[model samples]
Target: MGDRVYLNVLASRFRAQLSYRTSFVLDFVAQMLGQGGELVAILVLFGRTEELGGFAAHEVLIMYGIAGVAFGIADLVIGQLDDLPRLIRTGQLDVMLLRPLSPLAQIATGDIQLRRVGRVATGLAVLVTVLSTSDIAWSFPKLLLAFTAPLVGAVIFGSVWVVACSVCFWIVDGRELANTVTYGSNMFTSYPITVYPSWLRRLLAFVIPGAFVAYYPALALLDRPDPLGAPAFLGWCAPLAALAAAGVAGLVWRFAIRHYQGTGS
Candidate 1:
């Protein structure tokens, strides 16, 4: 019953977005253009140099593709959670708690934005373009990693979103700080982590685990060694990283919800 309710709410939200055809089209195009600009920037950088942090242009594109697709999916699904502060300030969350459905599910499915699919499509196009032209030594495991990497990356990013957004329950105005983790991490992971200084690299890799989102998986897919001297098998540990992040997000979310004190409006 809960699953059915969630799906119905999601479907209705999706349909509502499509109802505004002109606005939807414009937003969709804007999303694609915004994402395309990032891709173009990567191309321009590579034009000036053959390699970035020891990664060739096409190799970095693999990272961009995977990170782009993953972040797009995460944004489309739960980006609405960023609005929690507004909802809290308005006391609308009181209404949500009165409902039988899970509050997290309600918030996530409440305002589904179909236009974000444009970003996902853009990323997928890059992924396909590079996958076709790159000289990857494809095998069964490699093929599986290529197929699963984006999904795993999505989980990692989504978990980061949830854990970060949970801060609204405390600060009520921490979305900017949260974005430094959610959106900031997306930009950080889109390129080779090798380019970053050692301290920043370690922070992204160990502290935030953004490197597991796409960087490590790209290495696994490309059959390249980690430039940082980590084992090759660490590339395949993305699932573990996703699971760990999800666990932390779950705990943080539950704790925040328990401590939530309405605005008393």
Candidate 2:
């Protein structure tokens, strides 16, 4: 029943989005231009430099592709988290809590950002291009990793988005600041992790687990080593890292929900 409700909500969102055809197309184009500009910048950078840190251009492109696909899928599913502040500020969250369905599920499936499809398509294009052109030898594990990696990444990113929105339970109006976590982390993950300073790297790895969502997994997939001296096995730990982050975020989200004081609307 819960699953059926979620699907119905998702379908309604799709139909509603379709109602705004011009706006939808403009949104799609705007997102494409934004993402395309980033890709162009990365390519231009590689064209000038032999490599960024120790990673070659194509390798970094794979990293970009990984981050893009992961974040794109996550943004598509959970983009409502970014608007959580508005919901809280407008007191619409009361309506959500009153529903028989789960509040988190309601928020996630309540609205779909179809513009994110542009970004996902761009990432898949990058992935296909890199996979075809790059000469990395593939193994069975690697092949399996290719399929499952993005889904794991989406989960990890979605976990981060949830935690960011959970803060809205307390600071309803000012929660837009949480975009630093979502967009900031997404920007950071789009490049080779080795290029960043050691302290920054450790912060991203240990504090936010951003490394797991992209860098560590990409390293393992590409069979690359960390110059700042992380273990080779850290790459294989991506799934565990995601689970740890998601677990913590889930706990925080639940606690926040329990502590929620309505906007008194």
Best candidate, lDDT-wise?
A: 1
Worst 10 residues of 2 by lDDT: 168-177
> For each candidate, C-alpha RMSD in Å?
1.0, 1.6
lDDT of 2: 0.82
Assess each prediction's global lDDT (C-alpha) against the native: 0.91, 0.82
In candidate 2, the residue pairs with backbone N, CA or C atoms under 3 Å apart (3 or more residues apart, or in different chains) clash, namely none
Candidate 1 per-residue lDDT over residues 169-258, each given as its tens digit? 988899998888999988898999999999999898888899998899999888899888889999999999999998998999989988
lDDT string for model 2 (1-265, tens) is 9998888878887888979999999998887777677789898998899898788888888888888888889899887788788888888888999989788888887777887888887777887788778886799988877767777888888888888878778887646667888877888888877888989887876788888877777787788777778899988787887898889988999899898888887
Measured on C-alpha atoms, candidate 1 has an lDDT of: 0.91
Name the regions of candidate 2 deviating beyond 4 angstroms. Answer: 19-23
Q: What is the clash tally of candidate 2?
A: 0
TM-score winner: 1
Candidate 2 Cα RMSD (Å): 1.6
